[model samples]
Target: MKPYLMIALCCGLYAGLVAAVEPITVAWRDKAPYHYRENGIEQGFLLRRAKHIFALAEVPAVFVERPSKRIWRDFERGKSSYCSIGWYRLAERERIAQFSVPFHVDPPHMLLVSPGARATVQAHKGVATLLQDGRISVGVVDGVSYGPALDRLIAGSANQVERVTVAPASLMQMVAANRMDYMFADEADWEYLRRHEEGLDAIVEQRFADMPAGLERYIVCSKDVPAQVMTRINRAIGALSDAAPGD
Candidate 1:
């Protein structure tokens, strides 16, 4: 081969070596105000944050859809490199996944009760008191993971409370029909429901003032993911904190 031709080939081979690497895959769900599709693109605050993190790390990313349950399961099984913004740090989960520094501290969780049920339920002092006294059925979303706070509620009061599993969208239907006394979720999720579902605005009464401060949401990866990767994400999150929206 001619000397110039050899040099050209060597340079081309080096470029190929650099370009051959794969971009990381990030997973998201269709839940609005978090990760969801709009105009054929994955978009939301968390989604945007995820893309920003990838940019900071100088890693390419492909965002894909998976059911929320499946996404968490995949992370637990070590089948994916990405997961959603966690709202809180739990001791149990801390052992399983490494978290980026918190980017957003959510508002206190809001409780939306069926009309006329709020005072009756709250007056009773406890979930069981509300259920047994007011005969109110409490509904939680099907397949949605509950953290330690909710787990304790279920474990301690399952027998006294009427627990109903409904789809995220249908929970409002359940509440409206008086089949469920109340539906509780993050304020952002409730706001999403109000915007997307008509007539839903009038059905549930939102009580935002009385609740405790909510969990902080952060980008999380399986504990086994590289430390350098977690550090990069954490740094990216810290850097982005100034740009993050107000509560």
Candidate 2:
């Protein structure tokens, strides 16, 4: 090859390498305290932490706001680069997306029952029982993953339960009106709801079981995302643990 041709080839290779570096597009679910938008700016605890990770990973970042289910679907389909900041590990999800070690820990999700149906909320009974009685309905986002037990319950008798898949605020609205009998949501989410939404006073919160393993939130990546990227994210989150607030 000619000397000029050799230089040209080297430059092309360098350009290709740079082009291969991926910028992560994070999905933001408008869950208050964890993630929320204000004054046209996306901001929240997990989201801020995710921004820190992106900086450490040396990647550019963009936030995509969507319903929880849509976000997961987009991430799985590679329509987006990154999933939301927190989600539980799921075996089936592992087949589609890679997840980082706990970037942010979330409190266990508790079962919320309408005050009128408090008698129907059993600590150990199958959720199906309440649904079958026609006195209760469960609220969940259409595609949001809730571990095996809830999955089985929904699959086996989901039709019996009045199901509504909408934004976080909507679920609380359903609960307040007694239209939704049961809702499995993180404790913090409900706390946020109580403060913002009126009539949430009629709802009762109860802890049923430790959330299924897959439902525990973590930072999930697209299947094609490199493992090195995940490692960088883990390190960044670790650093955050030691980092002072707002650092």
RMSD of each: 4.6, 3.8
TM-scores for all candidates? 0.77, 0.77
Distance from true position, residue 24, model 1, in Å?
1.8
Q: Tell me how candidate 1 scores on lDDT.
A: 0.66
Q: How badly does each model clash, as a count of residue pairs?
A: 0, 5
lDDT tens string, model 2, 124-238? 3644454455445677777666666667766665334555657767877787788767787777777877897787787887764445433456888787667767777778877
Superposed on all Cα atoms, model 2 deviates from the true structure by an RMSD in Å of 3.8
